[model samples]
Target: MEDDPDWGEMVSRHIGPHQKLRLHQVASVPEWAATADLSRYDLIFIDDSKTSELREQTIRHVLARVAPETVVVIHDFEIPPYQNAVPADFERIAFSSFRPMTGVVWRGARWTMPITQLAERIDARKHMSPLRHSAWRRYLASGTGPAR
Candidate 1:
């Protein structure tokens, strides 16, 4: 997890000896590496607390670099501070958006992901054929229609 200097040390200390952790002070997202070999990690979780422009740029960078199978989980999706903060350009690229039916109080607001939308995506992906997988991967890479 990428974080500010103050939080990095505390987070690393709490994770303890068995876990591996590295801390780097980066002023902005563009300063970070443009590519990452996702084969080493099962999931990449992004906490979207930055400005809309930075968040969109970071998402695009990650999407281009990570493998198709890599699970990219983003937080603060339903939080008011983050919801509309996502720029129009990023929203256009996303295939779908979700919000929860049940809300949880966090940061003084109730936030959630809609259960129906989540279930639909889960079901659709589950039934996807090998061809479909390949097509979706291509779509993600090129930001265009699925492969023929």
Candidate 2:
């Protein structure tokens, strides 16, 4: 859920009628959760909340109810707090080459094949922004470095 209506509307306008999606601007993640069915979604992507803890909460919230095949991605995973947000039992696939860096996680191993195919299909290296920040440098130096 987006917090700003104007930005959300702009995004919706950019999305146009091509994508089968609806963007909602909710006051908080909890508000959106109140009416949405997590299990029915095949994929879930949340814009990073104002804080890392909130982002983690949102990530865990989806994992708790979504299907095993569902893939959830959130932003700013290159930061240590965001990386720590991932629970120990789950495996995270990090793409630290991107500007904000992305983290992909699911509750079980069912995510492997599809993510692997997607990684193959999407050439992240070509789209990679040059690394300039210390945070990203540290993330790349760590074991959870980008697949590319």
Candidate 3:
């Protein structure tokens, strides 16, 4: 269950009495899904670091094991690779509802970028604006963008 040695140390340092943590790393979801008894767990945390195909496959595998009421938390759902990977059945919880102290620790220094900042930037971008319009115009005139 302890695939990452530092994870145990990190959890111990941060988590207090009320939390119970379990860690498991399987080479593939099918391996974990085949062996795990999901009835016992009220919650499951899935990390979507795998390819889109693999992530979708894992979700289906997990869904088969867990009960309807079982809560599933998926990580990296905001990143471009997995942004559209969320299943339609699962309700999207607002980021503000969960105050996470997440950061990137590089060379023993903590670097933080707020999710709000990223969201704001995305919101400000004009879809099919000047850049895209110009590109489309060039593509139509020269047929360069379209694959032959």
Candidate 4:
């Protein structure tokens, strides 16, 4: 499910021609969760870019319902509140790129990489506008850190 129509359109344009994608646009995550069958999907991705805690709660709900083998990816992984929104049991798989930074969470299985190794790979860099990056850096420095 996609939260924004513009993003949905962008995704449609990029993958629509090459892949058969079933895109569903909802007003918010909670709306989607109400009707979606959690076990039907093998993968789930969320644009957890909102600063709202309610959005985080919705994400948590989605995570709770997914199967253990399901792969969940959260974008804007470095943003303050969003970055701290993941569940405690899930392991973070941070990528090398920080722009529109990405990270993975696996709740049903053991993480293939150790924490130290994963830490080495999550390179924090510019992912958003300069102003937003500055603000996010300050937010992290405040010691709130990631939700894990």
The alpha-carbon RMSD values of the candidates against the true structure, listed in the order shown, are 14.1, 7.9, 16.8, 9.7
- Candidate 1 structure quality by residue, lDDT tens digits, 1-148: 4536666667667766554444445665533526555456444555432575566566556655655344555554453433443333232112233333211111111112433344444335543554476665764456433344
The residue-level lDDT of candidate 2 at 139 comes to 44
Worst 10 residues of 1 by lDDT: 102-111
Q: What's the best-to-worst order under TM-score?
A: 2, 4, 1, 3
Pairs in steric clash, model 4: 84-147
Q: Model-by-model lDDT, in order?
A: 0.45, 0.67, 0.46, 0.64
Tell me, by TM-score, which candidate is best.
Answer: 2
Off by over 4 Å in 4: 17-20, 48-51, 108-148
Task: Per model, state how many residue pairs clash.
Answer: 5, 0, 0, 1
TM-score of each: 0.45, 0.70, 0.43, 0.63
Clashes of 2: 0
Residue range 122-141, candidate 4, lDDT tens digits: 33423434356566566455
The CA root-mean-square deviation of candidate 1, after full C-alpha superposition on the true structure, stands at 14.1
Deviation from native of the Cα of residue 61 in model 3, angstroms: 2.1
